[model samples]
Every structure is written in structure tokens, then in C-alpha cells.
Target: MKLKITVLFIAFISSLTIAQTKVGTIDSEYIIGMMPETKKVVEITKSYGAMLDSTFSIRVTDFKVRLEDYKLKEKDMGELEKKTIQKELAGLEQDIKKYQKNGNTLMGLKRDELMRPLYTMLSEAIAFVAKENGYTQILTITGNEFAYIDSKFDITELVLKKLGITIPKG
Candidate 1:
């Protein structure tokens, strides 16, 4: 009787472990970008990029005009004033180039800053959904890196549907 009881206990524990190991993978990028909140974030990102670009353009033109005026009067200015003007102009030029180079929504540090919170929220949501559905584990595999995931294991469709993403069929 004790041996049967021990076997049952061990079986129960094994099942519990198996249950907790429920795994799922998300095309996290797809999910995040699909959500409505992402649309707002994208607009914000675009606005920020435009603002940076306009600001940089104004600063560059303003600084260039000032530098030209300083150069025209360099002979009358003290060495200290000349050096200070050159340094300021150089700094402004650098700012213009840096802002221009980075003024794209696709490549800004703000992308990650905006995305991380969404990622965290997704993670929490995933955990909640998985527990409710008795999933034990979740994994994300990109197309480039994933060579062989069985179609049955590909829960992307199910997850997207569950998340209310109605992807159109091609």
C-alpha cells in the first residue's frame, strides 16, 4: 500500500513539473507593432524625429550665419573671442550632423526606450494567458535562426488570434 502511495506521489510531482514547463514562442516584434498602443508610439517617434530635424536645420543655418559674420570681422576681434566663436560654431555643426544622422524613427535609442515597457507588459500578459491555458513554457524563435519548428508547435496563429490580431491572409 505504501509503495503504491509513493508511486502516486512521484507521478503527481512529475506531472506538476511537466505542467509548469509549458512553453510558447511569440513573434514579439509582430505582436508589439500590431497593438494599437504601438501606433501612438510610432506617431510620437515620427514627431520627435521631425522636431529634431527642424531644430537641427535652424541651428545649423543660424550658426553658419554667425560664423560667417565672425569670420568677416575676425581681424577686429580679440584672439579669445575668435577662438570662442570658432568653438561654438564647431559644436553647432557637430550637433547638426549628429541630429541629421540620427533623426530617423527606425534607428533611434528612443525605439528601445518605448518598446521595453511594452515588452514587459507583453511578458506579464503572456504569463497570465499561459497559466490560464495550462502552458508550461514559451520560446521565441526568429525565422533566420529557426530551422525546424513543427507546424503544430507554431502557436503564432493561435496567439495572434487570442490577442485579437486579425492578420489578413495572403
Candidate 2:
């Protein structure tokens, strides 16, 4: 009976050890923002945005100029000519709207394309840090899903360090 009780106690303790879970939290966005590569992404995105803006601006300006010209000449033009001009103006307006929508979609695709590799690198770093620190689970604290997290469990800095990134002292 004594040997059986000792064996039961040992099993219970071993079970408790096996059930222990080490959880860590990381803010991947914070780590990505701190990365040096993010600056280049930001710059490239800005340049691309500027180019899109300029192209849209030129189209809008041309539309406005043509609209003003039509308005000025409408009084002197015949009925059929006026209708034709109006149709042209409507077509230009629709084209501008379509171009704006397409440009926004293209910009979104470009942003994702530019950031995919960075996100992959960040993911790998987070995994490495979690494994090295013996974390059974690593949760991302992003958006509004995570309401509260203990500071002790935060591994953002650890992940950055693992990626060879130096945090600025402030």
C-alpha cells in the first residue's frame, strides 16, 4: 500500500509538470515598425502614392478644363453639338471615377506586395524567439482582440533582439 501511494504521488506530480504551459505575447506591428526595412517600405509606398495622386490630379484638371470650355461654348453651339459635348463630358467623368477606383485597388495590391516579405521575416523571428524562450503558445496583441496582457509576458523586445534589431532607449 505504501509503494502504491508513492507511485500515485509521483504520477500526480509528473502530470502537473506536463500540464504547465508557458504563454508569451508579441506585438508584431510594433516589431515591424521598429525594423529598418519598414522605412524603405514607407518611402516606396509614399512615392507610389504620390505618382497615383499626380496622375489623378492631371486627369481631374483636364476634365475641369474641358468642362469649362463646354460651358463657355454651349450658348453658341447647335442643339446636336451641345448634346454631343455633354455626352463626352459624361464619359470623361465616368472614366475619372473608374480610374480613381482602379488606382486605389492597385495601391492596395502594391502595399501588400511590398510588405509580404517583411511580414514573413517578422513571423519567423517571432517563432524563433518563442521557441528559444520555451513558450508553449505565443499570442499576438493586435487590434482590439487583446484587452489586457501582463507586461512580464510581453516578448516584443525579445523578438526584436532575436532579429538583430536594437531598440532605442527613451
Per-candidate TM vs. native?
A: 0.66, 0.88
lDDT of 1 by residue, 16-127 (tens): 8776675666676677767777888788878877777787778878987988898899999999998998898888888777767766644467867877787787777677
Q: Judging by lDDT against the true structure, name the best candidate.
A: 2
Clashes of each: 11, 0
CA lDDT for candidate 1: 0.75
**TM-score for candidate 1:** 0.66
Q: Which ten-residue region of model 1 has the weakest summed lDDT?
A: 142-151
Give per-residue CA lDDT, model 2, range 40-152, as digits (tens): 99899999999999999999999999999998998999999999999999999999999999999989998999999999999898888888888889988876486678989
Error of 1 at 91 (Å): 4.7
Backbone clash total for model 2 is 0
Tell me the lDDT of model 2 at 110: 89
lDDT of model 2 at position 79:
99
Output the lDDT of residue 126, model 1: 71
